[model samples]
Target: MRKVFITGTDTGVGKTLISSLLVKKFNAYYFKPIQTGSKEERDVNIVKNLTGLNGEYFLPEVYLLKEPLSPHLAAKRENKKIELKKIFCPQKEPLVVEGAGGVFVPLNENSFMLDLMQKFSLPVLVVARSTLGTINHTLLTLEALRQKKIDILGVILNGPLNLENKNAIEYYGKVKVLAEIPKLKTINSMGIEELLTNFNI
Candidate 1:
């Protein structure tokens, strides 16, 4: 059972893509505890499409906010409070959990995504971009995770391979570079399956 929480440096940094890859790699259930988006824009649907997996591999989100904003704000708009106590990992093992944004994003007025990561207490694998300005974003993310005493598996650089960025992240952050995924011409199950070969997670 290889369970990991996949977070990113920020939103749209390929967290869902990495989650899909890991779900396929380990044949694990994909769980995104809090999703803040419209009904049609769910990441779980995208993951299910990419992995071409059945419903059993997916778990229902605890909070599915209709607004596409941060968890706290989205929940507020709906007049709902995001409670930590209501969240529980499924009985299924080898799960791949994904956070709703960057680690610092607030889940409520007081708690942050970092707190959710702590609640899950699973090892994290950060999905970062392989481009300019990534060094700073990645280092800060790593520091925050360390501050919470979270176990980090390493980083997965999503995008074109940039040796400079990769070396800097590994050297300065003192974290391993698990994989470097280049841009894909076509994103589907076949592409995801092929890309899984290059991953070391």
Candidate 2:
């Protein structure tokens, strides 16, 4: 795929970790359009350290809100407005863009993260936590994407390996289980590179 838009079922659902993995495997340009919480550890920082790729590999975020909240609220907190026209996708191939949260996450008063994905027109690579309650979360995420008529490339299960959850997601969602990512005690090139075997890239 030329582009892979990484999104999660919820916050802390391994979007950045998976994004960094895809960046390493594909040697793709990593971009997180809007980022919240600039004072603490940002996703870009984590991705940079994990992927071990610097220089042109990372792209600057469009919106950098100071609060660690939803884009809409985060922008609101700063008395700023998130204009869709401001978020532009770089004309780079093999790009891997990560969303802040689930597909339905609010970006502005009327727009959501899904709206941004629609604008990018890239196949979604759903990153879900591999644990209890993932079935419902994955299915609901798939359903939302379906309703939006967005193409879902596949699902990536992160955390412990759970066969039952994986089977349920594939059978019920009718989407391919692209890969299952186990929790890594340490994020390094060697370990991260090994997990890439489960993916086609």
> Which has the greatest TM-score?
1
- Taking all chains together, the TM-score of candidate 2 against the true structure is 0.95
Q: Write the per-residue lDDT of candidate 1 for residues 1-201, one digit (tens) a residue.
A: 478899999999999998988888888999999999865599999999999889989999999999999999999999999998899867777899999889999988789999989988989999999988899999999999999999999999999989999999999999999899898898899989888775665
- C-alpha lDDT of residue 4 in model 2: 86
Q: Model 2: which residue pairs collide?
A: none
Judged by whole-model lDDT over C-alpha atoms, candidate 2 comes out at 0.89
1-201 per-residue lDDT for model 2 (tens digits): 588899999999999888988888888889999999877767888888878887598999999888988889999999999888888888897899999989888988789999998888889999999999999999999999988899999999999999999999999999999988889987777777777865554
Off by over 4 Å in 2: 197-201
- Model 2 weakest 10-residue run by lDDT: 192-201
Over 4 Å off, model 1: 198-201
User: What C-alpha lDDT do the candidate models reach, one value each?
Assistant: 0.91, 0.89
